[model samples]
Target: MNIYLTRHGQTEWNTQGRLQGWQNSPLTEKGRKDAKLLGERLSKIPLDIIYSSSSQRALDTAKIIKGNRNIETIIDDNLREINMGPWEGRILEEIEKENPVEYFNYWNAPHLYVPLKGGEYFEDVQKRSVAVIDKIIKEGKYKNVLVVTHGITLKNILNYYDNKAMENLWDTPFIQGTSLSKIEVRDEGIHVPFFGDTSHLE
Candidate 1:
């Protein structure tokens, strides 16, 4: 099994520094361009399934990659960005300025600070993400699968791949728009790697 996961393109809220948790925000022009470039980059790869978050941002990006292919895309709510709840559209700096204690931790130890007023816990997100990923790997049903998802979800998922404790989920780096990360199941075992290569967006 070989899995490829990508972050959705940018949106107005993303460029404007707004917390868009589960918000149905559309992608910006630049975001669309990035997705287009990503599509061109991935067109050559043989894909078994295309999966996306239920959110518009992710589906929109996934569509771009589908292009003329008849690939089917499944929308999964579990793949959505962290739910910000009360602070869905609020500015992070404002939240931090007001909550100095949270701000310090967010800066010094992001693994400790919560993203927004009512965001999902990092540990919980990591646990769920890991379970989902492990199940997919174990199934070995698809030779190749493409997933378009959100930032926080990717971070938590990567935490599992990187062998980082769930307690430091936020320590995983946030991948930018159209960035690609992959995992492979060799006959010997499984291998999760952080391959810093994004020639598709060139």
Candidate 2:
């Protein structure tokens, strides 16, 4: 199966540096344009199915990409961004100021970081995200799919296929909004031909 993964476009919260986990936000003007551009790029490809997170930001992005196409987007909760719990809606800078230790742990040592009150565990995010894709693949259908999701969720799935440690989750470069990544899954294993490519927005 071939999966073309993309993070949802920029949102108001994104511009404000807010932690947008599980919280909904409207896409900014630039977000819409980027989505449109991505849509143009994907429109040239042969898409058999489309999947998007339940978040409005993701749904909107998917819709923009779908445009007038007859494709029906399958919305799934498993594709939703990580639940930030108490951290939702709060500016990331403020979180760093109020709880430097926890914030630092979340970035540098995700495995050791404690989940915020009512927040999701990193392990859970990775497991659920992987399970969703596995289920789709096991169904033996939907060979080519476009998955519109969030940065954290997309990162978790990418990391899983890369065989990277959860602790290094934030060590690499940030996953840009509206970026693209392609993964191919076969009986042998998973392979990432490219990851987090945002050249389309350039």
- Tens digits of lDDT, candidate 2, 1-202: 8999999999999999899899988999999999999888888888888989999999999999889888878999999999989999999989999889889888888898888789998888999898888887788687789999999899899888888999878765687888889989888988888888888889
lDDT of each: 0.77, 0.89
- TM value for model 2: 0.96
Worst 10 residues of 1 by lDDT: 189-198
Model 1 agreement with the true structure over 41-136: per-residue lDDT tens digits: 778888988878889999999998889998988778888887766667878788677777765764466567675546676665666666766877
Weakest 10 consecutive residues of candidate 2 by summed lDDT: 168-177
Give the best candidate by TM-score. 2
How do all models score by TM-score?
0.89, 0.96
